[model samples]
Target: MQLTDRQNNIIAIVKNNEPISSQNIAKELGLSRTAIRSDLSLLTMLELLDAKPKVGYYLKKGKKLTNIDDLLEKPVSEFMSSPVSVEENQSIYDTTIKLFMEDVGTVFVTDTEEELTGIISRKDLLKMSIGHGNLKKTPVSLAMTRMPNIISVKKNEKFIDVLEKIVDNEIDSLPVIDNKKIVGRVSKTILLQTIMNIAKKF
Candidate 1:
């Protein structure tokens, strides 16, 4: 079961103050007791918390905290967005325009056959621009990080694995490859949004 952020916060409060009252929990969260009434009820129904007459809620003994393992194990294909790509030979000026138009932090670079070849980041373009390079005359290839060094994820890869790659590499996004072709792209924003959406559902 996936616990919403509020639910997790409630759990922490109860853990630290086992005899905490609903009023106190709401106060810690800057919400009214009525506002969190449903959350408290749900947690109780889930057996994660217990209530006593004239007392407040408390963590149920031996009950495990909620986990998002199922959500994290979801495939990348379910959350990846359409990739914003540029041809290897496309001019830096054009690529920069496309990047802004799409509002993406990174863009995939492809060859004539549309095969993935490299990746260009906003930082890369910024560095080149600051150096007074002629953007219109420079090919995106000159500003891209070429393959053999690029970190990519497969379509069926788990979200947890993709997150690890992004964090370890300090990258903003990754291209999703299938059959050696770029099918989609995954980014920190997408993953975060996925979690936020799930929280909203509950």
Candidate 2:
């Protein structure tokens, strides 16, 4: 569920004084009772709030990243891309052409077992081949940032925290991992699209 600024503000207010009645909160915040009720229901479904018909709603306590089971259960899965990979032995020319044809900015480099070994981005290739060698001869592995060097996320990660990581790390995308296998990617485009879908009504 996407939260609007108003709903977020209500969350903050509820956090400060949880177990708050919908009527009391509506009066205090100067928002319509119907609007508060609707937002409250959505927030409850998102697990951000807990509500009891007569008892009202209370904010769920904890840091955003601390308890993510709820967030992971939502449209978060929809924002991920199937993990795409290329072999380490692949040539830069072939990789570059494929990347362009696929219109992707980066591709993960994996071993024969499909474990993530590294990541080779369009920028990585461009910078590595700028001055010296033949593009067709240069191997993608030589230009890839090794696995431990690239940032990655787990399948159950929260969308908000993942977005914060992307912005703070100044990176384009993060590979998603499951059982030591590269399962998917979470990119800026996906994040934006998810946000748009969630916020369209607001």
How many clashes show up per model?
A: 0, 0
**TM, every model:** 0.71, 0.63
Per-residue CA lDDT of model 2 for 28-71, tens digit only, reads 78978997777887777777888777887787765232343444
Residues 1-202, candidate 1, lDDT per residue (tens digit)? 6679999899999999888889899999999999999999999998989999778788888766435688799999999999999999899999999999999999999998889999999999998899888999999999899998999999889999999999999999999999878999999999889887766653
How big is the positional error of residue 110 in model 2, measured in Å on the Cα after superposition? 0.5
Which lDDT value does model 2 have at 179? 89
